[model samples]
Target: MEIHFTKMNGAGNDFVVIDNRSGIYDDLTKEQIERLCDRHRGVGADGMLAIEQPVEGSSSQYRFRYYNADGGEAEMCGNGARCFARFARNLTTEFEDEISFDTIAGPLVATFPGEDVCIDMSDPFDIESDIELSLSGTPQTVHFMNTGVPHVVLPVADVTAVDIVAVGRELRFHEHFAPAGTNANIHHVIENGHIRLRTYERGVEGETLACGTGVVANALVHHQLTGAASPIAVDVQGGDTLKVEFEKDADGNYRNVKLIGPADFVFDGTISI
Candidate 1:
């Protein structure tokens, strides 16, 4: 198949954006998606996105379907959504200030505020216990939460000192949580007000340049621990700053969590797979 796609990035987390609104593409096998995501031999992306017709009874114009580098489907991705919004804007000749799309996570609102893409991420879910995982022969205590998707956050002393590739894989395949695994995020509090971080996404299964939902998960955990204010800034390894904001209800549950970051088009091309 000949695939025409736009390469986009959000804070260095990249993806291949394909417009399948006309239903030209059909079900893609996992091997095909994985081959396309191969850095050296393929298009080289964290994942692939298909902008398709909205689901039944959906109010939005389109829905974003995301597949990881491994060709596995994911419910939602913060960075991928930003790139999807930006790519959609570039595709349309009509000028639109704001846009909305549906995903497995439900309705999403994206605003093209000047040059950046800001998204109204749905409320986080599954805030649960903190546990210890054996990684690289060391037992590390980690916090698990789902900010749109499940994430395991581990507070590290030095962000770069941890071997994310090895440890992340271990935790991603841990027997305790088998079949469907979770993303691994390691973060360090830069100061009382900021966080520095890296993440091993489940589908991508590597340290991405930046992760949108990972930032939100870490920020929420930080807020819970320190009682910080809204709009927390996170410095990701990709050298971009992601702004996170949320509301904590009287019961201390998170609501209205959002992620704001940079999304830009890198290039466009066609490839045969």
Candidate 2:
């Protein structure tokens, strides 16, 4: 079957978006997703997204279903959600400055501010210690938080020196996280209250230019450690700066968490299966 898809990117993490509200295309398989994501042999992308009609009275009228290049469905994707919102808007030409949609992680709301998209990410779960494997016989001091998806945030002295591919794989597959893995993020605090980060995503399985939710996770972890709030700037390995805003209640629950970053349109085309 042949399908029409849009290629989009947020920061640097890219995706192939398909609109399935018409239900015209069914029978999508993992192998097809993988083939389409092949960088050299096919239309390469980090993952694939499908836009479906949201259930009645949903925060919005579209539901985003995401699959990694491996064809496995992920609970949520921060960067992908931004791309999904943009794709949906363009598909219907029904643009809204703010949009709400549902994902496996629950309802997500996003707002377009100027030329950027900011998403209200899920509140984080602050675990006292690393629930999974610690850093290679090192102490278990990493902060655990779930912003859309589970992430292991490790503060480092120099993020650049860290081998993200190797260490990230180790943590992502740690037995504690089990059958389903988690994304790994390495963070370093830069000057003037900015944090630098590199993330190894679970589905993509490598470092991308930027991760929307990963940036939010890093910012929240930084705030937990440093007690700073309001807004935090995150420098991603992709060389883009993502701004994060949140409110910490008296009990330290992170609410009103938002990630602001660039969502750009690369180009669009149709493909055959």
Candidate 3:
């Protein structure tokens, strides 16, 4: 089969996006997807995004399906969602400034403002703070949250000083979060409402240039720790900054969470599989 796809990136985390609404690419296997994401052998991306028909009874314009480089389906991906919105808009005339899509996480609404795309993220839950873990015989302090996906955020003194792969891998498969592992992140607060972060993503199984949900996870954890306000600026390894905004209710629940960042088109091509 020859598949037509668009290559896109949000911040620096990239993807291979296909319009699957026609059901043309429905039979793509996990192995095939893994090959497609292979850096040297295939299209080379952090993951893949499929724009499919919305489920029955869903009012969304389309359905969003995300696959990690390993070809495993994920609940959500913040950066990928932004790129999905842009890719979907350009493919059809039915959408303009705003678009809505359904994902494993839930229905998400997105808007395009100039060159950036902003997504209304699902409300986060299952928050745990100051959890102590023993890594390499050293006690580490981390926070946990479910921002569409499970994540563990470690506030480090210097993000660059940490061994992302080694430490992140350890935390990713730690028995503390067994079975369904968690993405691991090490972040440093740059200022009152700004932070620098490096993440070892779960399905990607290694470090990527950026991660959308990881960014939001760290931002919210920062707010929880220091009482920082909304609209936190996060500097990712990709050399781009993403902004996260959320409102805290009187009961300390986070709502209206939004992720704003750049979604750029890299290229488009047809590949044989």
Candidate 4:
């Protein structure tokens, strides 16, 4: 079987975007998806995005189905969402700078305000603070929240020195977020409205240049602790900057969340399975 695809990146987190509207690519085996994301054997991407037909009563132009490099289905990917929007726009003549898409998480509205595609993300829920975690026989206070997917933020002094692949994997598999593991983020505060972040994603099972949802989680957690405002400037491992904006009410509940970042086309090609 031959399939067409576009390689795209948002802040260095890359994805293989496929237009599966015909529904023929819907039943790809997990092994096939995993192979497609294999760096040595396949196209080499952090994940794959399948553009499928919209669900019943969905106002989105299409539905975005994402799979991790490990071939597991995910509810959403912040960076991939931007790439998906751009791919949809390029194929959708009616869409200008904005597009909406449906996902397992829910409907998302994306707008290409300028060079960046800003996505209106769903509200962050299941927020818990200072949860104790055993890190190498030492106690660590990690904050938890679900931004589309579950995440645990551990404030660190230097993100560069942290063995994300090791510590992150330990936390990712911790019993606290068990059964379905959580993504781990090493967060450092630059100041109010600014921070540096590194994430160990669940599906990818390692740290990428950037993690959109992780950045959002970083900003929200910062705000919750420091009483900072919206539009936080976040510096990611990919050396790319992403902006996170949200409105938090009196009770610390966040709403109107938006993740703004770059989504660029790397190339387009087809491959045989």
Identify the leading candidate in terms of TM-score. 3
Estimate, for each residue in 87-187, the C-alpha lDDT of model 4 and write its tens digit: 89999589896789998989999998889999999998999998998899999999999999999999998888889999999999999998988999998
Residue 89, model 2: lDDT of 66
Q: Which candidate is the best by lDDT?
A: 3
Compose the digit string of candidate 2's lDDT tens values, residues 96-147. Answer: 7767788988898878888888888887774545444456887555767788
Residue 67 of model 1: what lDDT? 90
Candidate 1 Cα lDDT to native:
0.85
* CA shift of 37, model 2, Å: 1.2
- Number of clashes recorded per candidate: 0, 0, 0, 0
Residue 60, model 4: lDDT of 84
Put down candidate 1 lDDT per residue, 102-200, tens digits, no spaces. Answer: 998889988877777889998888886568767767787878888778888888899889898887888778875677888888888888769998898
The alpha-carbon root-mean-square deviation between model 3 and the true structure, to one decimal in Å, is 0.7
Tens-place lDDT per residue, model 3, 71-166, is 998999999999999998997887898999999999999999888999999999889999999998999899999999999999999988889999
The segments of candidate 1 whose C-alpha lies over 4 angstroms from its true place after superposition are: 93-95
Of models 3 and 4, which has the larger TM-score?
3
